[model samples]
Target: MNKKTIGRVVKYLKPYIPLIIISLMAAAATTLLSLYVPILAGKAIDLIIAPGIVDLDGISKILIRMIMVILLAALFQWIMNVINNHITYRVVKDIRKKAFDHIQSLPLSYLDTKQYGDFVSRIIADIDQFSDGLLMGFSQFFTGLVMIIGTLCFMFTLNITITLVVVLLTPLSLFVAAFIAKKTYNLFVKQSEKRALLTGMVEEMVGNEKVVQAFSYEDDAIERFDKINDELADVSLKATFFSSLINPSTRFINNLVYAAVGIVGAVFVLKGRITVGQLTCFLSYANQYTKPFNEISGVVTELQNALACAGRVFELIDEEPETPDKENAVVLKDVKGSVMLKDVNFSYVPDKKLIQNLNLLVKPGMRVAIVGPTGCGKSTVINLLMRFYDVNSGSIQVEGNDVRDITRKSLRDNYGMVLQETWLKAASIKENIAYGREATDEEIIAAAKATHAHSFIKRLPNGYDTVLGEDGGSLSQGQKQLLCITRVMLSVPPMLILDEATSSIDTRTELRVQRAFAKLMAGRTSFIVAHRLSTIMEADMILVMKDGNIIEQGNHESLMKLGGFYSDLFNSQYKNV
Candidate 1:
């Protein structure tokens, strides 16, 4: 609806502007040449029928001219269409690329706040709608407008009084189109948005299928899906109803105008105000004007649908992301990897603190381990360390520099992290292990060997060239963890964090992984978030957290000597393992 945004969308056509212009010119030539056929028809009737005499030579020349023009125009139009369609498709590809790239630059909070289905729907389906509008609107609608205008002028020249009356029906056609199109656009927009939610639910359900089956909530999931599907059905029904009415209603109004013009032309001929040939010419032009009117009306409805999609797509691009640092923000550099958390209270939502009045520090190269009950802010330390979310009170510092003052990329680049769930994409083992780092295959193999993954990788049919399934389904959990650790090793960050990396593996695998973890932790500041206390028994420092507060801290032996929370947790938590 906004012209400026429309202009921005049109700017996408800049690269193809010359081709588009040729297409428009071809449309004009076709329309104008085709108009001559009627003129030839009128002349043939006047000379051969009205005069009761035939001049074959003059008639043949007119016939040949019409045929040649028709052939040439058709060929030109066909070529233009071929060229224009290719360009339009390319423009669509570019739009998709830009939208996705911008979406990535947005904060992780953006993904959390928006529905996954809705976001994807905008990029895929919604962008398609806009692409259709741009392609067809430029190629057809503009040319149709020129045809309508040119044909109207020719009609007026043939017979002024009749032309005046025929032009009157145009407003009626416009009114019908405007009213129906407005309503249909609104419906389609709402339908697209709601459909996104339904699609999103489908995606979420499928992704979490394991959780659904494990919890025996299959029936509940089905019921929720049914509700969304039902809503989708209802909205689609209404949207189609409105959209379908567009053509029929517009056509009906146009037919009424066509009928009125035909009747009026006959009356004019009877009154002797116009010749029979001229009356026929006026009749032909009436059809000419109305044909494009119908086309423009149809384009109007199509444009509405495209605009509906535009609205959705624009809404996503316009979303205000979580604020990153300003352009002038400092890059925290040359760190010895000392970390400080001073009186830091945190929450995912208001009035619900996850960590409260927390304070801690770890000197460079110390292995600091955090142990707690399931929800006692153990992983929150890593979150705080990474600055995924800012603290509600107090500040986190890296080597005396406030984390908030540094750019997020710069701060995060200084650390390497391995989480409890090691996510792997579908890629070659070498690429997956090296990931985004600029590491040579030699470096990558070295890192893999360090994490005990190189031997298993080499045993595969393709070795480093073997492709992984989604989330590395082909590999065991411990193997996946080892590869993930190898990936972090390639990054070689100054600080390291392992969040329950070995917690879920088998005892034998855990022991092997523990050795690898120990190797990775040497000569770097490390934070280990663990529930299984045995894994952290060798930690240089242990912090016992209960309900968001650090209740005890010391080396494992000293904490056991104190017989406090750490001792109680160490004795109780890992009994099964």
Candidate 2:
């Protein structure tokens, strides 16, 4: 790409400048030492080939010194390589951690449109491309360049004409590298995208394997997986083939240049200006320079792949999270849990309003039950109350303060929320129940006992310490909901919102949960959202909602006397249960 895009990759390495500088110096020293090896070989050959009366003592000492220098250079090279790996891995680790934290902070809408599998692949496989750049591309490419330049300087001292002929591969190698890099770049990009799609598919299938079995579509699912596998193969094949071109093409070009160097050397020897030893050393320098010629194209290919990954990772890290509190945001003080909505208006999307000009008030310690048909804005009300999404055109106040003025942490901390879906992380039952609240072992047991979950938990092999499977899949739905109830009771916020938390439970468990609810809502302002009217017969203020408007509201007895929407809803309850 352009200079700017390449600059982005350097951003991650800026923090490790000292290590990079040290490594560069070490690499240069190693290249210089390697270049001298051929010269030493040429000199030793001349001493024997010319049949001169050589000084044995001097020659032996020179050989020993040369061998020691070579060993020293190799030791330094190893040290530099170790440092390079350590720094690069640390940088990549930071990139991964920051990206993960940013993704978690993103709004629900951001997650709704993205696939979990695709996100996972980018976080893992895509970042690996950068590892190539760090390990091989930068160090090898720069060190090779230094060796080539240093060899040219030394060879020109012996014979300029011969060195020029051998150095011809330099520009040719560049031409091939540029061409291969361009083509390989596109292939790697395609491979990355296809892999993400494949990852997304794998995640979806694995998460919903139950549904596939229930519908008897196991064969169809395999067929679909095969299609993704083929796409991944096609893209990966193209990238591998294009990247493979670098090695052979570069080697062939280098072999031809070596032959030219040999021919040039023969001509120089006939002129008798340089000794056999000098020509051999010159040839060795050219050979050392040309070896890296084959390596350049491979480095370019690696660089292209790394940049592709850089773009993906940077895109994720740059995503802005949902709106946080403003500067000097007011904190709601000593909230007595009096909630009010004045002319409230909201929509998940801008075009269709789910709650239109709605108004309601929940006094401190009042039990309000919100009832509506599915998607009639019942859950949206809870979403607004929790400030997951802000109201578009109205004010929702807690106590005497507007929700917008308070920090989200403080606002959420004031309310205990239990959603219909019980998402229990794979952890010990005690840890799951005490989540978001710092509680002692005694408090944890009390919360579980309060929800009637402790009785069953004690019967497990490990009791409270038993590890739950993924998403608590090992537990029955009723048990999962009981765990959720216990989770909220432990937090014990001043206000509680239960949006069908008992919906998936058995009738027997539901009755127990109702008792837990009674304890939880004792002195707290609570919102009980229920589809079944029989479940909420004891609600102090039963508000009936239809078409985004509250048509009737009163105590169960008072609403039944009115013979309105609540009465019709109560009458239909027998048909369902």
Candidate 3:
């Protein structure tokens, strides 16, 4: 485990300092009281049992004191546990929240490249293990140290010679513990990494179960899962086996110390150097001292595991987030939706250029259509316009203002978008349409009717109130597309982006959707990314893109008159349909 990672974990406790202090004090008091009770018991024997004659009054008083001390010890122990739980879980909550917020702030590109299940494991399983281990390790570690030191002080007062023997033998247990811990630390780290990998595998396979069954790849999928599962089991077993040896090894050394104390105490008693009562007290303190060593050894293993988990959590927290907006950045107002790209260049990777020297000037309220084959940088233009990614060279401007100079939120707020891949939350159809904004029921119904969705929605058991499953599972592809289109219609932004927005709807439904879009786009700038030639035949301007550059531009008549790539593309699709 890295020291920096452990330090980061400890920093989370700063907010709960008062609770931590109380817990520590309670732990100390609990250990001290429990240690003192054994001494009280020994004195009772000297006063009431081991004496030449017993005194009933003295015996009764001593018994009462012992019971009171026991009760206090129990009370303190309960307090320590309760406070430890509160502090640990509170820290866990903060860490999880921080991780989640960081995820929200990360760049879309970052989320695109990482595995989804790894994030799930870190937020849920890893954090849970870290908190549980820290709760046990911290409480036991502090109390164990206090008990060991307090017991040693009492032991020295009774028999200096015998105490020296215990001190000499104590290092054996510590040495054994340190050796075992050193050997198991790397194994625990490896085990944690493997567990995360295994979790990601399970998530990916389960999420794609339909695809697997359709292709009859069940045997292959099972083989891959079994391979990872077996590796996880093997690493876990090794780590557990090594950690399990720590307690017994320490226990063995502590037992030897216990035996030597007995021998030395007998020598002292026979030589008349100490009373039998003092011998009994020293022996009890000796047990208390050695027991902490054993307990602390167990805590060492847990602490190491906790640190391993903490390291993973800290790694996620340390990731650099998307660059912040410039200080006092410009906020667009009353956007006219004029967009331009001047000598722009971009690529998902640096070595492979996808878009170079791309230029366009679009007027407000113009219906523009961008058409291209696969991998021709069609959607890449939309990504740059939205600032989901920035152009590597040159500039993209909205209303003649460079997009880079504007706050992302303010720039994106002017445009409403519906993509080929539609998304809906697990909520009622009405709530999903409204999303976070307020909408009148009449307005929602009007939007649905415009997209030819009102009839199907009303036929459902609860109309707009029916709750959706994940990704709106109850709806067909066309129905889901209609809902998404309805969302964009309700927003009614100054600009629109429809990427295959009506491709899933039936021909009859597509006509209604296109009519609704025509009404919505009457006075607003609209960019339509479409494959069907019929959808964009009425566009005010058509950009025929190939290899990231616009090779031809004009309306349908002028482009077909050129008899170029656009003409071929239009004729091919027109014939195919």
Candidate 4:
């Protein structure tokens, strides 16, 4: 077991200390009543010492007392179980909530490098596994400890010499349990890791199944899945095999203790040192004492697995969150749309430089279009503008105020964005369009009509109330993009970012949407990223980027006359058209 991880888990129980105390009291009551039953049975046996001399009335009184004690023990046992269930589930709920909240605060840079399904596995599956083990530990561990101690006290009162014999053999059972538990912990850790890997793979393949089938990669996907599945199976089997050894191994040692006590007590009875009734009571105590050893060994096995799962959960909670905003950061308000980048440098990795010494300036209400080949840092500039990433060494200013000085929320609220990839939740169309802002039915319908999406939306069975599945299920790519455009149109912020926003729509719809976009961008400062040269013909200024540097900048007419890189790029697309 990991002492550090176990200690952390115990801290979650502090809020429920009173409940824990009550449960312990119940466990004690149950153990005391159970111990007394054996003594009553022994006394009843003494009353029937000989056939002719049997005291029927005395035996009957002992039986009645035993029945009452048994009923009380059952009641307390039930109370302990109910309380344990409550405590175990509450602790699991708290840990899960903390993990999820921490994931939200993490930086995008961290999220970009990890698999979504692995996080899902940790929060859902791994935490559930930990809950199961924790529940078992609570239900059995404390009761078993009290029973072991209580049985030993009663046994010593009847026969001290036999009780010593049982105590002497305890170390062997402890040693066996400890060794197996130590071996099983690491195996369980490996099993959890493999399970997460499998989950990630499954999620990826299912989400992109069309791409796999289109490329005839089904066999390769299956091979990769089988490899991970085999690993999980192997580790799980080993973990189970080792943990399973604890109960029987401890029981074997316990049986030896029971047999030794029986033999020793019988010898004492023959020598007149103890009566047969006392011998019977001592033998019962011997059996009771050893039973907890078996039960405790089982608890040790489960706790090892629980601690392993808990270690994974704690790792997520302990991750460093994104750097917080300044304590007294100013909120941006009523902004002109001017933006400036001065001597900015940034890279996703430290060793490789992507953008360096870059500079640009855009005035309010200017339509500046960025054009380049695929890896020319077109979208990266948008990322920097939005503060999704910070510049390594220089400054970005909005309306002459340093962007770092402004709160992120207010800064983001000033701009509207629509990407090539459209994302919609599993919700009604009206709800999807009205996301991030409160809008009435008239506003939502107007925005949809403006984007030329109202006709198709009205054709659906439920019209505006149709509930789509995850990511706008069964909706054509063109339809999905239109909804995203409607979302931005509804807000109409002071600044706009449109990156390949009309790529998925047909040429005719693209023409109509571009006109809608023109009206929307009439007075707002807009940054357009495009691969098709014709879409950006009328930009106020065209920036031709190559290798993260601006190779050319001018109006389209001037760039075409200069016959530079931009001219050749435009002519190539023109010929293709």
Candidate 5:
């Protein structure tokens, strides 16, 4: 357990000082009440049995006092529990909200490498375990301490020698608890980490279950899951087993102390050094004193578990977020659609340069096509242009204004994008198309019609109001592409990027969508990244790329006449047909 991380968790409780005070007061009251009950019981025995003649009225009054004390103790315990629960869950809610919001602010580079299930486990499962541990440990720690101290003081008053003996034996319980906790803390940490891995594996497998079935890899998937599940079970067993030993070990020591109190008290009574009533009270106090040792040991185990969970949560909270915009960053306005990349260079990782010294320019209303083989940095160009990533060196400017000088939101606002992968939330079809902005029913239907999505949408049971499943699961690939195109059409950005936008559509349907796109691109600057050579034959400018370098540039007819890389690529596609 990291003290620094655990300290950070305690800092979250600072704002709830008032609630903490109330809970502590309730715990103290409960402990005091419980301690007083034993005293009343001891006194009742003395009042009735110590006298030569039984005092019936006195016994009844003492019994009433003892019952009232016990009842009050139970009530305070319930109140303490209620307050602790409130404090614990409220803290957990705040932590989850902070963690999720922090995730939203984090950079894509950080999120890209993280698994969804791991994130979910940190936000939900880890926080839950942390909260439960805090609730258990916090309430018990306060009450148990008070109960031990009160019992010790009462026992000292009854017999100082016995109290001293009990105090000396008490260190044995602490030594045992600390030793076991040290051994189990690392085990619990391993268990928590394994649980997160198992959750990630399950999520990854289920999310790609279709692929698994298509490839008939069910046995492989099951084997992988079994390996992870077995690791989790092993770690969990070791952690819980070690922690479980704390209670019984402490209990054994406590039973010895109880026996010692009885034997020593009998000797004192035989010597007439202590009265029967006082001996009886010392025995009662001894039981009460030893009970807190067991409670403390149990709470120590819980604290270790809680700290393990809190460490994971704190690690997520402390991740570096996206770099902030400059103080004088300007909002990109009056965009003329002219774009320029001057000596641009970028790489996802250092020493593995993907795009180097890339430079390009396009005038307003130009239809520029970026053609390249896979991994030729075509998508990297789009990513840099949209400021999803910034160039490692050089500049990207829109209308002569450097993109880095402009706010990211304003820079992205001027572009519409459609990728090969379509993303649709579980909402009405109309909502998915009108995503980010409001539009009238007529405008929505018009955009859908323009992209040839209206016909199939109308055939649905609820038409535009029909809800979609994950990524439009019920829709065909062609239908989903059309919807994405419709989304871009409704956006009506000054610049458009279509990256394999209509790859899923049939040739016949693609032609119709292309016509709509031609109309959409009439006055806007456009970038088309395509593998099919025929799609970009009429593009005003075709930049042929090979290994991140532009090897050829011109219209289709000029490129064919040149008979360069572009001609060879164009010929390769037609040679197969």
Candidate 6:
């Protein structure tokens, strides 16, 4: 067992110390009462000296006392179980909540590299495994220890020779159980890892089932799933096979000790060193003493698996969160939306440069359109501007202050963003439109009308009150885009980012929405990224980017006259027209 991991798991028990103390006390009581019953039974047996001379009254009294002790032992055992369950589940709950909260604080770069399904398995499946292990340890492990110690004390009071024999043979059982447990731990860890991989693959395939079917990738998907499933089965079988060896292996050793005690005590009885009744008590204590070894061996097996699961959960909780904001960071307010990027360098991966020493300046209320082929770093520019990623070198400034110098929340509050892909939660239309802000029904309707979504919305059974499913279920791509557009129309932030925002809408609806966008963009600084050349013809300035550099810059007429890259791009789009 890892001492460090065990220590960390123990730390969660600090809050429940009082309950743990009470439970331990109950375990002690239960074990003591249970151990005393054997002594009472031996005394009742001693009362029957001969068939005709048996003391019925004394035997009857001892039997009554034994029954009372047994009942009290059972009651304490019940209390311990209830308390153990409470502590185990509460600890698991705390660990899960901490892991989930830490995931939210983790950097986007870190999240991008992880599998969503694996995270789900860690929070749900792994934690549940940890919970089971913890509960078993709490319920059985400590009680077994107490039983072993208590039985030993009772046996020593009867005879020293038999006690020594049992003690001498006990280490064999311990060594056997320990050896098997060490072998199973790593196998259990591998099993958990493979299970997570399988979960991630299943989630990915199911979530994109449409794409899988469209590409006829069913056979390939099944092949990949089988590969992971086979690996999981291999590790799980090894772990189960190793852990299963602990029980019978230890039981065989314990039985040897039991037989040794019975032989030694019987010899002592024959020589009159102890009576037959006393020999009977020694035999019962011998069985009681060795029985805990078998139970504890089982507990050890469960604990090994639990600790393995816990280690995975703790790894997530301990991940480094996104860098914290500076203590004296400025809060952006009353933003004029003048933006500047000077000598900026950035790359998603080190040693593979994407944008380098890029420089640009946009005055307040200027409409800047960035046109480029795919993978030319157009959306990346928006990412840097929004501080989703910081530039590797140089600086980006809003108004006159460096973006890093301003609080992220305050900086983002001044901008409205709409992407080609739309997002909607499982909620009513009114709730979705009013997300992140308070708005009246009147304001929601007006914004929806402006984006040309109010017509279809009213056609629904509940209109604004209609509760949509996850990601706007059954809504056409165009309808979803309009709802996203309505979100920005309601707020009308001082700055805007539109990355192919109307690509999903029909031409007629796109024309109507473009008029609405022109009205919305009249006095706001906007960065529009569009593949369609016609949409950005009226931009105050157009920048044509190639391989992360601005190859051409001018208005529509000037760029057309320059007859360079921008001219060719525009002409290509209108060639068919």
Each model's total of backbone clashes: 0, 0, 0, 0, 0, 0
lDDT of 1 at 91: 81
* Candidate 2: tens digits of C-alpha lDDT, residues 1-577: 4356577667878999899888888888898888777777777767774456776776787799799989989987998888888887888898888888888788776777889887798789888777776577656887777777888887887788887787665678767767777788777777788888888888888988889899998999899989988988998888888888887887888878888888778787898877788877876776787877767667777777777776777787788798878888788767788999999988877787678889998899999999978888888889889988788898999987788888888988999988888899999998899888889999999999888898999998999999999889579877888898899989989999999988988888788879878878988999989997778888889888887888888999999899888887788877555
* Candidate 3 residue-pair clash tally: 0
Clashes of 1: 0
lDDT per residue, candidate 5, 225-257, as tens digits? 999999999999999999999999999999889
Model 2 accuracy (lDDT, Cα): 0.83
- TM-scores of the candidates are 0.92, 0.94, 0.95, 0.96, 0.94, 0.94
Reference-based lDDT, each prediction = 0.81, 0.83, 0.88, 0.91, 0.88, 0.92
Worst 10 residues of 3 by lDDT: 43-52
Per-residue accuracy of model 6 over 1-577 as CA lDDT, tens digit each:
7677799998998999999999999998999999898888888888888879999999889988998999999999999999999999999999999999999888777888999999998999999999999998999898888889988888888888889999999999999999989999998889889999999999999978999999999999999999999999999999999999999999999889989988888888889999888888888888888888998999998899899989899889889988778999999989998999999999899988888888999999999999989988999999899988888999999999999999989988899999998999999999999886899999999999999899999999999999999889889989999999999999889999999999999999999999999999998999999999889999999989888888889899999999999999988988989
RMSD of 5: 2.3
Candidate with the greatest lDDT versus the true structure: 6
- Give lDDT: candidate 1, residue 556: 91
Which one wins on TM-score?
4
* Residue runs of model 4 more than 4 Å from their true location after superposition: none
- TM-score of model 5 vs. true structure: 0.94
Error of 2 at 3 (Å): 4.3
Runs in model 2 lying further than 4 Å from the true structure: 51-59
Per-residue lDDT of 12-106 in model 4, one digit per residue for the tens?
Answer: 99999999999989999999999998899889888887769999999998999999999999999999999999999999999999999999888
lDDT of 4: 0.91
lDDT at position 298, candidate 6:
92
